[model samples]
Target: MKSPSRTILIGGTLSAALTAPVVAAAAPATMDVTITIPQLKVAEYHRPYVAIWVEKAGTPPKTVAVWYDDDMQKNEGTKWLRDVRQWWRASGRTMKFPANGISGATRAPGAQKISFSRAQLGATAAGEYTLVIEAAREVGGRELLRIPFSWPAKAGAGGRAAGKTELGAVTIAFR
Candidate 1:
């Protein structure tokens, strides 16, 4: 037989051990993503709508972020977002408009930084994944860029990809 105090201590320790994994999984680290949209010399140039997402083997792509014209009247701006063909077919059409944390106005020609936590990524398991960025402009061409990296990334792990006309440079860094 055990003393009442000893029994209480043992029960508390067991409870902590059982809940440790759940707590750890819920705690997510930060990932920084930088996207650069180049200023093109053209007859008419419009800010490009961009979509960023992550894809893993045998799984459908998951949207991490999307940039489009959020200032249009009556939310009509979203109608043209389908021009980002790949993202639209993959995961865009199914989602409701103006998604929190994932939707924003189109950015100007420059590097834009966005951050995401593991919880925001939605069940990001440790494995290989691809970061895909696609951009389409009004009266301009479309471009898609992809960078592959591992999840639960190691220190000093990062990669960059560039597009010829629409996109400038895209980079991902894990701390």
Candidate 2:
């Protein structure tokens, strides 16, 4: 038993405590994303500059992530990033040319994985979202692909996708 003020305070504290867990549980989950680049013919030996990101149906796509075009010291990868088109305009165009994340080096032909979390992306950061991947090779053809999924940082929320020869196969595991 307690005074009215004490009872209200305790009751309010209890109410908040009970709902705190629910709020945390409602935060969706994290997403695991992977991308694979394929081997091209000898004539197409240039490792592509791949741009990966998330797109929301109603929202115009924004550049949330990027790979390659980070080796532009002497204008090396400066001209090539434009091949990815979408990423070029979204965030690559004005970038410092060569970023260290994945410059010069090209991904080998095979299945490769890249992981991103809610804490690692924006635009399609949460709620309904679609994953988009664009590959642009020096001599090969350019292609785009997408996977639709919700996100919040689930330990195993992921999906797999196969790219044209320019991209072998992509696997995403959110764990």
Candidate 3:
């Protein structure tokens, strides 16, 4: 009864692309992702606002995967990410409440699973893609976690790694 050693795979610089570059015809696929915010040394777990998205290498169009509820009035969970400037601007700052996918509810320090379909994903190729996770603590600062995951959006039901600063562990699956 021994546990496996988990490693953090950090690659890709999707965040660099804030403008979201347009790409060729992307293969229609679905990406089932799980976001986990590991325990932090700090108190007051105000439920961090997390943003997940995919981006094309050397480009501008970075597809938004999942952005926490940004509706301040309706969801205070979102306003917390102002520190996560990147996501704040890309998504949170929008304050429009995730249009379709999951509801805008603050998640505790645990696993939050969600799935995205091709219908939802505009256009992306199935060659090489990046999985970007941005976590913004309520009282804490922000941290960016990057993982270069090849797509169809679905290859192996594996995860990248958890960021020590903000996220604990992050997993993305095809099933």
TM-score of 2: 0.68
Best TM-score among the predictions, by candidate number: 1
Q: After superposition, how far is residue 49 of candidate 2 from its true place, in Å?
A: 0.9
What tens-digit string does per-residue lDDT give for candidate 3 at 41-86? 6656666767776666565434454455455676564444566677
For model 2, residues 1-175, the per-residue Cα lDDT tens digits are 1144235435544554577857445543234456667655575377677887667767656454555644457766666778899777765676664443323345666665554435444533457777778888777778888777666545454666776666666666553
TM-scores for every candidate against the unseen true structure? 0.81, 0.68, 0.64
- Better-scoring candidate (TM-score), 1 or 3: 1
Clashes of 3: 8
Instruction: Give the better candidate number (2 or 3) by TM-score.
Output: 2
- Local distance difference test scores for all models: 0.79, 0.60, 0.56
From the highest lDDT down, the ranking of the candidates is: 1, 2, 3
Q: Where is model 2 poorest over a 10-residue stretch in terms of lDDT? A: 1-10
Query: lDDT (0-100) at residue 72 of candidate 3?
Result: 64
Off by over 4 Å in 2: 1-30, 58-60, 94-105, 123-126, 153-157
